[model samples]
Target: MDIPRSFTIRESTHRIHNPLDDAKLAVLGRALRPAPGWSVLDLACGSGEMLCTWARDHGTTGTGVDLSATFLASARARAAELGVADRVEFVHADASGHVADEPVDVAACVGATWIGDGVPGTVELLRRSLRPGGLLLIGHPFWRLDPPDQAAVEGSHATGRDDFLPLPDLLAQFGALGCDVVEMVLADQDSWDRYVAAQWLNTRRWLDENPEDELAPVLRAELTDAPVRYARYQREYLGWGVFALMDR
Candidate 1:
């Protein structure tokens, strides 16, 4: 019913929960330029940043679904902080099978497509809640560079080489799925550093404060190795982006 404790702890301070930063997220909002009063549905909406921010920026209304109570609290707080509380709502639930009671102008599953298994299935799920001509925003990683070996693949946190497709292949996949790739915002090395390094800091700070906690040892090991692993493998091989698609 909720995310793992480790993941919750690692991204405790994250607003977006992906490699995207505020500026990039703004760029995405600008790119989409959703009409005023549009309705958005975000699945696995961590902290509800996208919905809250877009509601503020575009005068849109939104609903966010997530499993993490901690994140939902943050999301609600963010909505209040942004003065969009009335425009956005957050529900604590599994997003995998969630379908909006009313069709939405935008349906998104950012960085959590595992909810519906993978890209294709996630798209199908999102489409179920999308109005005709509405946008579908899918955030996922692609292989920026082919891994040379299993060590590199594992370092990138992918179980195998085929876990991600090359960027071109990924775009082609959307076409094959009968969708048009209309717009995208990609994360660069700097954003990746921001996302990954923040987790290290969070883990380290938690370990320092809770040295006696049972999870300390596990996080301690992760913090010790994450920097090297990210620098060597993930930074070079993985490229993540949120792609806006429309059925063709």
Candidate 2:
């Protein structure tokens, strides 16, 4: 099956697929309080940064699943680099309808809840793989402030087409999915800068290679114009975070 080409390309770069920073990731790892024997199933686990870090810091064991072969390779390489290769496995597979091969202490879908439709469906799907009282860490976007207009809205990278909710509604959606919010770690503007600005670097490189390519124009313009608008909209008016959940 074909995955989103942008996502696969983003994975090949080793930066986060979303606007997250080391501080935010540290918060996520600490929020879970992973233990030596604890196992975490990181669904749609991008480059496996969280898994590798958790294993190194907490001795946690886990598997990370993603559709991108490129991402899985990076995750494996990172696991080895962190000396956690034995503790984590990176699997290349579609995670939309997946379950853990074995029950885990944590089941997470960070920045990719769309794998199961949205927060509700994703939490339900992940819950099946979680042990009773186990933790589930889901990363998603929220509004820092209400958008001023459709232009402001588009600048934040949200589409009129998707079913994104505000933070309050997102939290409520989690509750509706049969989970209680136990903890959360939000990404500040600096974190957003890391995510959005890095894309400029990526897009610039892509443009340099495919100068005459049609899509390059739109992407190049997005790269040039996005930073200012993104900082104004997403960084100033929208926030994103990872939340810890449990079966209620």
Candidate 3:
């Protein structure tokens, strides 16, 4: 009922699980302008940041589902800290096929589209919990520039170049799925650094504290290699964004 220990350790300090910074998330909140008291359903909502913050800032109520017990604990704490404990709920469950008991004003699956296999399947899954005319928020990656070869692709954490489409093709994908791209907030190289670089520090700190832990060697290796990998490939070739979509 939990994510891998390696993943939890690597992201222990992250409030948002994706390549989005708090400012970009705030910008997205303002752009969406979800009405006060609207309901939201967030799938694979790591740390429940979106639900907790939206409940605090927009007067929205919501439920967030994720399999990470560690992240769910953080999410519940954040809800209480934000004074939105009653407005949002965090569930420890598989998000892949989970649908809200009631339809919601906004449904999102940010950065975990693999829960539904891929973009098309994930989009359909999100729609199952959305009310008529409700918004869908999808967080996905695109190719800022085509990778030159397999090394670049692997360094960017993708198995193949086809794992991400170029920016134009990504937007076109939404249209093909019968959705209109309403609003989007993109991550620049700095945002990528903020997200990926922080993991190195988290890993190093864990390794320092628990030198004999079973995962220490793995973390040490990652800490040593991740910076070079990210700077060379991901920073240049991978672009990520959360796009607001509506039925066309």
Candidate 4:
């Protein structure tokens, strides 16, 4: 199985699918402090950036699983490019129920918690592959400010107000799941701009090159409205971060 073509088309140029830039991603790898030879499992590992980069920088080994064949190909190439092909592997598989064959030092489900239904379920899923006291990394979005109404929620790309919790409540969720929040790196408005604004350019470029393609209209519409929607709604209301948690 594979992700929708439209989804990949929109993010074809993204190395890291979330709001994290390269510097912030490096900061996260350092904060986690995974020793050389430590093992990691990254579920829904888009483009395999986290695994490949950590394999390069920290000398860690890992497996990345995703449903997107296109992304998996990019991930594999990234591993080779970083000279970590021997240390990391990318599998084109559904991450929802894919646990590591053996316990790992770090288990992560970044920015795709829906694979396990929601935060609690996703944490539980990650824990299944984590060694005792091992770290679990969850990337998620929280409400930066409470939305004014339903329209604001939709504008932020959420179906409803309940789709996401406030930042404090999100941290509390880790506690509720019996995990201690150990470290976190948040994305500011600039990071959000980098992530969302770049998609518009990618879409626009693709639309220009493939104007006759059936998806061109969709891309054109998205390019036309995404920037304003992101600037007005998502940038103001949504904050995203990757949180490191340890079992309590």
Best prediction by lDDT: 1
| Whole-model lDDT, model 3 | 0.93
Per-candidate TM equals: 0.99, 0.91, 0.99, 0.98
For 199-226, candidate 4 gives per-residue lDDT tens digits of 8888888888999999998778878888
TM-score of 1: 0.99
> Candidate 2 — which residues are off by over 4 angstroms?
8-12, 210-215
Name model 4 segments beyond 4 Å from true.
none
Residue-wise C-alpha lDDT for candidate 1, range 88-158, written one tens digit per residue: 99999999899999999999999998998999999999999999999999999999999999999999889
lDDT of 2 by residue, 134-157 (tens): 998899888777787877778777
What are the per-model numbers of colliding residue pairs? 0, 3, 0, 0
For candidate 3, write residues 1-248 as lDDT tens digits: 88899999989999999999999999999999989999999999989998998888999999999999999999999999999999999889999899999999999999999998999999999999999999999999999998999999998899999999998899999999999999999999988889988898899889999999999988888888898888899999999999999997
TM-score of 3: 0.99
Report per-prediction Cα RMSD to one decimal.
0.6, 2.1, 0.7, 0.7
Task: Tell how far residue 240 is off in model 1, in angstroms.
Answer: 0.2
lDDT of each: 0.95, 0.81, 0.93, 0.93
Rank candidates by TM-score, best first.
1, 3, 4, 2
What's the lDDT for candidate 1?
0.95
